[model samples]
Target: MTEYGYFLSCEEFTPAELVDQARRAQQAGFTRLAISDHFHPWNDAQGNSAFVWSVIGALSQAVDLPVTTLVTCPTMRLHPAVTAQAAATSSVLLEGRFALGVGTGEALNEHVHGDRWPSFEERGEMLEEAIGVMRELFTGQQTSHRGRHYTVDNARLYTAPEAPVPILVSGFGPKAAELAGRVGDGFVTMTPDADMVAAFRDGGGAGKKVVGGVKVCWSSNREKAVDVVHQLWPSELLPGELAQVLPTPAHFEQAGKLVTRDMVADAVTCGDEVEGHVDTVRAYARAGFDEVYVGQIGPDQEVFFDAYRELVLPALRR
Candidate 1:
């Protein structure tokens, strides 16, 4: 049987509401929880981007489900040394039930400090070195790194995990997956592409766990849900260079005129029907994911969870 779970998109909920949602998810039979780490929401319609680490702290006390960052990048907004400590403390707070899912972040999240957003090459370099810094701190060693992207001076992680907190690297490209396989404890990607899994393993990430996440929109009023996600998340469709020139949600919304509800529905599951969503997730399990997480991007978390707990999870668990 597949172990079904929930993924809380932090962009959609307030800090306290997020904690409550996780707790409710636990009560509803979710075995694990993955929270998204975003510094900013692509649109105001998306509404709310709380610091994920703080949300994790509350979830630790409020729920029993294991937690992982769907992804956080220590390479940019945060120094790896500090991220190491944060990860360690989070593990402690969760009583050793936390994993750190990391990635080379997008400019939308990392460019907030008015810092020069390095090219992908520089970001990869930073990620490569940052993992080393995290590994050193995880070992409970007093360490320093003089790398091209990072310089740490006599750093130590006081709160190390009782058990190792696995580092799962999120990859969108071959080089990133290769790096994850080389440096990470596990590999994470959104697509259920086994060739990508094999690539990660081939890159020397032997025996690393593979995890995937997918989103579904479930509601009796499917059109409402579709409109919400489309209105808020049309940024998903912005083409290559166009996304760069578009600065805000309003820009994206204006550009979103090019996108229709069908486009959103084509990419995302749209409807209250539960079995189809189950099939959607089972596809990941069939693709060889050790674990798969499903997210509802519709409005009304309470109704979504009720229907999911009563309707969807049973089908997936079987």
Candidate 2:
């Protein structure tokens, strides 16, 4: 069975807001929760970036639903050992209801220390090495690793998880999916692309979980919803490598200008149509996703939760 969950966008919501959303999501019948781990928001309009670990702690206390990092970068901005400790602590806090979702990461979040961002190929290599380091530490055993990308000396997670924390690797393309399959316990991606899922399974993810997420807006006024998405999430429509390589929010803002309202209307599911929202979310299940998370864009979260609780979710389940 495919589980329906909610996505908590750390870039767009404050810590309190995120915690509140998690509670509300649970009340509204969401089975699980996923949250983004970003050091910076994609643009100023989004206007928030809270440390995801802290929010995770709050979420553990606020809701019973399991939480996963929609994706976090362990190769840079933070060491894998540190990330492992955090993940282990989070799992302990959630009583083993946590999964660590990782990725090579975007320069927007990873370039903060002034290190030149490595190419995707190099980043992939680093991520694989980092995952090895993390898995070793997750066992509560002392680990020392001297890898090309990172060095950890006799580091151990004393507050280790009671059970192994599943590490889900994120990817947007086939090569990344293959890498996720080769090394990850599961695979993560945003789109519900069947071909991408097939590539992942063929790359050794045959029995592993496939998780994904989507964003939609439920507004009484469709045009207003489109405007909100256009203003707050135009970066979603940016072309290929632009999202991965952009160095700062300013660069993203500059590039986001190319995305128009019409494009957002055409590409994003906006407005109060229940079927539209249900169809968008169900696509992930159709693509073989074991778990699908849906995020409601903009400030109209109450209506989204209400509608999903009363209409959309029931329709999808039907």
Q: Model 1 compared with the native: what TM-score?
A: 0.93
Error of 2 at 177 (Å): 0.8
Question: What is the C-alpha local distance difference test score of candidate 2?
Answer: 0.94
Worst 10 residues of 2 by lDDT: 273-282
Sliding window of 10 residues with minimal summed lDDT for model 1: 240-249
Q: All candidates' lDDT scores?
A: 0.81, 0.94
Query: Could you give candidate 1's per-residue lDDT for residues 1-318 as a string of tens digits?
Result: 446668888877789888877877887778889989988776777788999999999889899888989899898788898899999999999998998999888666777777876767777788889988898888877898898878999987777888778999988668878988999998998887878888998998778788888877777887887887787777766665454344455666678788887898788777887777888888888877877877777567788788778888877777
Model 2 regions more than 4 Å off: none
TM-score for candidate 2, residues paired by index = 0.99
Query: How accurate locally is residue 212 in candidate 1, as Cα lDDT from 0 to 100?
Result: 81
- Give the Å shift of residue 157 in candidate 1: 1.6
